[model samples]
Target chain A: MTSNSPVGQDFWDELRRTTQARIGLGRTGTALPTRRVLELAGAHAAARDAVHIPLDVERLAAQVREIGIGEPVLATSRASSRDEYLRRPDLGRQPAPGTDIPESGADIGLVLADGLSPTALDRHGAALLAELVSWLRDRYTLAPPIIATQARVGLGDHLGAAARVRTLLVIIGERPGLSVSDSLGIYLTHLPRPGRTDADRNCISNIHPPDGLGYARAAQVAAGLVEGARALGRSGVDLKDRSRTEALGPPSGSEPGIQPGHSPRRR
Target chain B: MIHRQQVSGVTYAFDGLVEVMAKATPLRSGDQLAGCAAESDGERAAAGWVLADLPLEVFLNEEIVPYDTDEVTRLIIDGHDRSAFSAISHLTVGGLRDWLMEMAAHDHGAEHLAAVAPGLTPEMVAAVSKIMRNQDLIAVSAAVQVTTAFRTTIGTHGTLATRLQPNHPTDDPRGIAAAVLDGLLLGCGDAVIGINPATDSPQATADLLHLLDAIRTRYDIPAQSCVLSHITTTLGLVEAGAPVDLVFQSIAGTEGANAAFGVNLQLLREGNEAVRSLGRGTVGDNVMYLETGQGSALSSGTHLGVGGAPVDQQTLETRAYAVARDLRPLLVNTVVGFIGPEYLYDGKQIIRAGLEDHFCGKLLGLPMGVDVCYTNHAEADQNDMDSLLTLLAAARVPFVIAVPGADDVMLGYQSLSFHDVLTTRRTLGLRPAPEFDAWLRRVGIVDDAGRLTPFDPTTSPLRSLASAVAP
Candidate 1:
């Protein structure tokens, strides 16, 4: 961002190109430059607001239908409000009567929840859901998407169990950092049910426009995991993302896992 | 009889709670440790006699007048002298007109008694501690600091130490490494040098651990490091063999608060087991770190419905006892000022709340410390922290956090600084934990007189790279 300046700013431009991280920003005597401060303040505001603002589940459901992902059945978690959800994560992780998660018979449960950042869903939920439909709509029967408000990763488990879906694909908004408030995340669980621990699911984080896991890549990853989970009869640490790994290039010969050795993302 | 047990010149509580206590686990390791279970059994038998014989007033409400209270009082009337506590406990709260007049002559005795009484409430501790001399305050309290395989307590088992929490703006190892370097150069890290990395992913946590591991190993510093994030994250890291000395989590005083955090006793048990399996504990079998503050409970609306619900912050904090009573922690920090003046308005209020949390946590039989801090928006300054820090030290708090430059860039708050630690140690004639102190001396950071020498960061292995990467 600083590279567009005229005062010999080539170094900062180089750094910016190499990493989206806020490095090489010139400072003003013991403090950050004013523009950087303003940008950060704006970003922080977005993150905080994202946590508090309630997502319009009806509008989200309509958007999903418009995108032809299928008509989503709007639902609410046990947490009725943003404050309650923030206070009680377990409530958000449960499927009570309010969520309207229909009981019985579906090959897969699809949940689109306004998680830690509702803004993330507003930005990328429809796109990702549409992408998932393009890939797996014919292969598996997706129960009407349950538009969840105030939800957590575990909410997917509850939704799937409520619908008796064999597998689940839940898209959620991850907790926003000082920057990057709209990062989307996907959690896939096989044999989805309540009381399914974190180890019973797989996580693919940081899906957003530009500078993140692209929807295509995220779909590829999710599809691979789902296929693996159905074959192995489970998800999470037990199942590897080896399918995606092989697709990415030369086989790493390891299970699907986080690659901490090299991948860099702005926290 | 006013029965009691004393070990290593420290008096142990063998009263009401002990009656229900399964067995005592040695909280810290160092000098002579008389088996807690043996004494606990003895106390349990004595309590059994009293429970069966003593007619007690039982309330359906939370408050119950323990038979031990009357038994202890009866012994005092019968001329028991093992503790001035017998004399102090039976006192009416009629202020100067009541017990203070008669107890003035037993000032020294009461102060000592109060320090070692494990079950004394914060208000009671404050009252007794208020009457003692500053010099007496230090002497009576446990001055012994406990250390884990990688971490150390600042003072004695009951006294205070700072848990240096150097959080990075991001979970960037580079940023955290710089901040930690700053704190270390100033002779902080008396409490375990831990970081609160912003990144929630387990891989990033592993990176932070591996980075600190390399730094500490290269310097041979006597400190353990942890990314003071969620216990689940730390649990995963521990399972992965990342260098974790303490598993950290935020717990509240009520079941609702714990639920809000998605935590329950079962999860804590699992986490404790995860840390225990490491077997890297240096301080006896104790190996847990829990954090609790007030707003969390109130925000959950748990405080509104119950008849005796925690209406105030102090009462709200005590609810944490319900959670802590199950999982025994090696270190617990009552992050007082971090709540800001709204909950605890101004310096005086902050000081009182800090003491109350410390007192309450200690009364519940956990090794406790106070995190002396304040947010930027709070109507507090360094002067307030200085006063609170000194009082906490005088109270012999288990630990306090010594941040780099006293400011946490990531958390956006000001807390105790590395300079503060040095100043507190030098002025109070206090030192870091024994092993940590030895490490400090061995590294020539402090002299034989326990005075800090001039620190030259240029000499550090990280200096060259840090300077190269300096923003």
Candidate 2:
């Protein structure tokens, strides 16, 4: 109907009215004031105030290299233009020719991608990386993190294959939103390679300032995923099943005694 | 000591030492002893303390009867039908339409179908089978065509062509036609966005329009819902001095070298603006397809090749945000995004990386941008309805279901309707209304008899109709 119609005038209105009422009634008097107080305190501060210095990509890449880190491989796609990139994904998976990769396998392969949110990378990439590296160090003998630039999600697989790492983690920026779009996401794969499907990867997303999956937790989850992948041989559903079964007890019996004509199945 | 006495047919026993035992003994009943034993068995079962006396085979086989022939049959039939239906559905809309072209050729004797359908000769039986398949496809295609037409007729249409295909790796013509119709409806009585066939062939455009018209007529779309004469294009703005008041473009592919953001933006800003100045719309009101552009960045770098650099997360987010923000002010009533590849790096990351990160995060982050964020190319095979409904519920926004292949619209519609029924009731904790006026508004349906009355569920003629349909 017309846009001018009031709520409750039609089925959609009724639905909206009911939903709004439910949300309103359910969340009543449960609002937190701490966030508002913190927001007010941080209002005058610059977006970059949290960090001591601005990030220098070239310098960071060099430093990562000079620290005797693994060889830095550059990720580029044959879809040299945007139109081709959108239409052709096969091109985005392969890396450019002549990019250097370490002769021996590294402990971890670090890939920095623009992902959907490039601007977000400038804000959350460092903290996410730092947290990730620290967490990795705590758990395993970490080879220096090899930061691959201008990479895609699939590029991580290629880099991982080239580096021969047990796990490849790509910390890319998430697309910005009105509230907190500058979030970072971590995508990890065990035994990464080209043509690797999404089922082989796991991600910890929304790593940003507020209302996000924080770096420490994300790192822990990533580490846990790596360890689980090492044991389980893959990520995504495989790792999820392992983690879930570990958290809860395993199945008591082969048959769960689930019977036919049960309401549980019907529902 | 006991003594037995016989009285008629009954025998009674009495103890000689009864008087001596009465002071020292208590009465016991057989029924009470039996009840105690049963209670002990129940406790043992509850505690899973199996007794050695019980046979394992009894627990394994006798206690459990897993087979339910009725359920198994139903499941098998349902599964078969679903699979067949899905295949048929895809064929009818996407493949059937393509087949229609082949059929026309066959009718003209350009090609033979013996290669595709080997066993079936040009006999009547094979012909009937082919016809039946076509009919099934047509039936499903009609349902999809009708629903889309009805939605478009009411004016709540969004980008339809830009969605991903379910079976194939490309867009479906039927789906695109439906979307084009929807766009035309939204742009009714005003100029709106349109797609120029990438091939740029006049015959292709004509054929597309003809097919669209045939589908519309076959489905009996209302005469008032007329198809536009020309497919509107961004290029058209340049030719016409009367450039549209505004243009909204999505920055999805801006990050990768392959995206069209740079060229598109340059054209819109420099070329289109040079022809005529157009103001950008605010975030919530803007209408465009920016979701795919931004979402693509997840898997691929930016259109400008800036993605691979060691940019900090903030910088990346800000740049993406800037793209969305810049496009936000220029958006119109409809904004669409890709939920499949662009927003989601992969299918499994729905909560963390997919919906949460790209779709909701990016759209919501845009300053007052996107009245409705369309999630295109959703996983139709899975029970993604809940995920989609949950995301929408969380965001408190309206959405459209985009399924691949034209014939699968019915399945999509059924899934959406089911989801709406379950989620609306569960989340809102309310009874179904006579009419979902808010849904109509979101989709843009209006009652013409009531002076172009907007159909608000709270107070609309359609309310009674919707109420009648409510389960």
Candidate 3:
């Protein structure tokens, strides 16, 4: 290659080390280097393959049961197959006929769903639930965790309404990205029901281990959101996650609307 | 409104214009899911036949979504340019298709198409598109020229722009900085360096804004920056005197859908005015970057039409262009496959939707781009994106979103990578926006021939930026 490039190898290398994003790969005439090209294809193939991987529901339930919060209930959405689940999102939000979920009237309902990426749920679902349970078990009443297959985020609403819980936390496998296939997401809805829209829920996404949001931090944020939803009688847009602010301490200067410990308010 | 037709001795009757339009739409999973798609190919052909004979003026008289209830319908009616309409007002939908194709073949066709753009409604343009092929969509879209500018002029002929989407999973400045640097080296960001912040909080949005602004200022990049937050959150940042370049919002076709997004025409107008008043542009003042997708209305349950029938996603998607046109935005992009298989299904549908969106936006006189992307769950891969990217490049789309390695970790989708943009530009003999093209040469990132130059990163001029944001 000609010595006509302006980028320094050391600075570019250092920057690449800071992020998972592909950077500083030398190009071959407007094309990616051969290794990088194959790496991308392989990553994409892996991510796509991960989407079709079925969650080991039985193993997952056993792992969650070991957490000792509550018994695990198995369920399936109206979508009977993986192909149907991908094509019909509406079907994935409704419970299959005669699911028989108990209306326990618990304060919190937890649902673990094999969303677009069952591989994500298979990998981190139990560990994240354990962390979240550690934070909530002492202060709140918990219901049996529902492990749903062929499910979407909205399935939690139906499950929550059936369970008669005050707050529903749906821990779902997010759509797999090329770089991170096993990332999990949490959606918290206050008084979740059959018709609750996304605006009625608050999301904490990118929950994976080692690189993405760690289990402890994600659990801390989920717990804080639950507290806010409980205090305000709502979730979603009305509730903002201030746990990061609390951890970082109050801003140096007194800015207007910067209440240190005030309850959640409507936007 | 003549909603019935006969084909192969089979008669098909539609209830109204909305039904005809919906049933006429080319096969897409969204229309099927909306319960408005024609029951069979024969039925679809009949609807197309009926739609073809319908006069362009019929669109002016019949409201698909009732004008009284839909602000989008009202905007289309209230903003109709009578003088412009007179030129092609007599043509039927089929005549418009012929007229557009004929115009595309002529050298002065671009000017004629641009002149008639204001006269067209989203419905009329969409109607013509339904009867046209993917090649026809590309030909007509290529003939029309819609240009806008902020720091760099986009949509100029022979130039393709890219929005450098350097998104971070946590809105971390360092992670974002690395991606931005990577994009810049690959000749991206001519359209804008826009970030979709993981959090919608004003504080996080403001911080990302400052980070982008500092990089732009230090590098003197010939590009604009946007933190793609809700219009309300962005307006608040503008009020707080952040370096707001482009006000970004994800808009839909109907008032109710916009409401679900917590925005209205009035709010968008306010955001446009606020960003324009900032006088932040070095080259031009068109400073709004809007994103639209096919299934947003249906996704939000706001896709209802005349007689409560669900309008097709494509028609509603084209209607969103009117919203973008009203704001005189710097850029408008359809995230074609981003909504997944629920709307577009596999690669073929996505490619077709991408073309239709570009064609309609161009016909409606808006600088249009596409985020040629898809989710992993959508039965699509990089090969699919390659097809769409190549097709859009052939169509001369104003811009496309290019992220690092074609992966948006925050958004969880695959878009065109920086190398993809580079390859597309090289393949089509295209260059970036003029200002950015000049800056690339000035900064020695590329030679005068627009070819990349190898250099030591330690001595690179962008080292300062890397050092500033390095953790």
Candidate 4:
């Protein structure tokens, strides 16, 4: 329909005014430069390079052993078509049968994946992994390094459940932006299992080279989630509630100074 | 830094500074190379791609190296080359930009080629322009392909954005319903309220009643002023079935009187003629919702089921004119509170684009510079209220927003408060009746006292309403 329709015209005029007002406000300081974009692109290029190089599977296996990882599981899948992947999100989340883990009970199940941004892996994977490993070592004993290729963020649930781990933390590439195409995202789940919802997971994103969320920080956050999940007996919404309570100090109810569930009785 | 090697009738002076030359000379023409070459009997050949006619001025670190043309040709034929000629050839215009940047770092001639190429003589410029254009096209195509590939990769794995997931249980279905409802609500709030008006089957009628009950008890909403819109097929209107009149009578005192159903005519037209027969006398306060068809006034092809009619700015205006004309009779005869077009699909670009037209201006034109515009379903948030206010202000139309439930009503009030703070006055108003209160109760937002609270404003239930009004 034409813009002259009552609603159409109103929406146009309002959108224009809102956009103008936002521009006039200049709120975000001229949009900070995004380093993640560059790193993501660089990482993608590196991943392509790695794919082309004659990969020594044996060498990769040796590296896994060196890290003291036990037998790790692997998985892969392809989009129905390249275009279908882009236009329809409903199709993207459907995991192949064997790809999903049945249950999770391990201390920590590490999953490697090529998310929306495969290039992110090449750029930040090494540093992020190193950081995650080092910090995780300080907290809990990790199981074998579970490297799942071509995985989505949700895959962590299955992997965690299958490994029967207390927690599953997935490191995957994020979708590339025009500027920062190769950023990594970490998804952590406590008591991971299939059918776990988004609220059940926590994410630390924009992990890339040079000033992104490093592995050490990610590991700390992940460890907190695992420990909290163990205490709360749940993750996602429940975990968030517990964490918030801890951070904010028990909602002001347990204190002797205040009564429960009422705004402190006004004087 | 200079070294000399003599071979056959040529004495080649090679600088020790050049590593490639030093390695090349000993293997090709040296006495040690001759002995080894004789023993191998041409069974093994030197590796790397060889340049047959090496440009004389080509230098490696200020060193000069000599090559035997025949030997270089043989080496090239043997498929031993280190040059990146193939990589360069595959480079498109975008690729060439990178290639040129790399080359210009060390080669002045390459720098000159990049500099002069943009503004060269007619013939040379034309050829360069053609290549650049082709390369640009290729780059665009590749970008599209890459985006598609990324989407496919994510979709096949079922890992699309979490936002699109169903909003129920832990998820918020109100937010989801609001998104669908907002498209209908856009400019009108006081004039319309969406009802679950299903009269199709006994089961569907029961579902509608249950929904009505939920809206009533949950949010404390009044029933008289609202209209029901159904996404599913219309229930058959039989005596034993839940007659619309009987249903209204049943919840007459409660907020049920305000509700009406949204009809899906396309689906109803296919059902047993009995359903269509019900439409003859059954159409009362209920709206006849029909999207535009081709050859109609509004003709933008963007709308989902408008029979491929274009629904851009002009077409939207024309559609408004047509709606004003055709629906006026039905509205006047029925004494309905309002008449509206069936729901507009997302991204129609019409309502936002056509507010200035006299057709809409005159139709909605009210006294005191205030038009009684109805927003079908709106989120209760400052930004949503601000957006609606801004749109209304632009049209000089004072508007009301129909909140589906109590949470929405609270947010709507909060949005009003925010608007007062931000705009120095409240230009928009909230109209949440008992029907909305009932919905609130169903959704667990309101307590016995009819109060609601959301935990996080950024990700609050209130914000879900705001998204419904998002452009």
| Order of the predicted models by DockQ, top scorer first | 3, 1, 2, 4
Off by over 4 Å in 3: A1-9, A61-72, A103-108, A129-144, A164-167, A189-192, A199-204, A213-267, B469-471
lDDT (Cα, tens digit) per residue for candidate 3, span B97-165: 999999999999999998988999999999999999999999999999888888899999999899999
Pick by lDDT: 1 or 2, better one: 1
TM-score of 4: 0.30
Model 2 segments more than 4 A misplaced: A1-56, A59-74, A81-83, A174-180, A241-267, B1-448, B451-471
Q: In candidate 2, what are the lDDT values of residues A168-261, reduced to their tens digit?
A: 8887754333234366778877888887876667766667755566777777777877888888877665674232335554222111111111
CA lDDT of B347 in candidate 4? 15
lDDT of 2 by residue, B264-379 (tens): 33343343333223332211223333332223333343311111222111112223433333332322112222333333222232322222222222222221122112222222
Model 1 docking tier (incorrect/acceptable/medium/high): incorrect
Q: Give the root-mean-square deviation of each candidate in angstroms.
A: 13.0, 30.9, 4.2, 27.4
> CA shift at A192, candidate 2, in angstroms?
1.9
lDDT of 2 at B41: 27
Across B1-471, the per-residue lDDT of candidate 4 in tens digits comes to 434444444444422222222122111111121121112212111100111112211221121112232221122223322242333334333344444334434435333332332221111111112222222322211111000110011011111110001111111223323422222121112122223221223453444334333432343322312122232323343334433311111000001111221222223333323332345221232222221111121111122112221112222222222222222111110100111111211112112212222112122211101111211111112333344334433322222222211012211111121112113212222222233334445544434444332212223343333333322
Q: Write the per-residue lDDT of candidate 4 for residues A1-267, one digit (tens) a residue.
A: 111224333433433332111101110111111342243235434433332222233444455555554655555433354333322333344455656453434477787666655556655665666667776776676766655544567766666766788877787766443234566777777777777766677666667656455566565666666777777777665564222334555312222111111111100
Q: Rate the local accuracy (lDDT) of all candidates.
A: 0.58, 0.35, 0.87, 0.32
Specify the poorest-scoring 10-residue window by lDDT in model 4 chain A: A20-29
Let me know the DockQ for model 1.
Answer: 0.03
The best-first sequence of candidates by TM-score reads: 3, 1, 2, 4
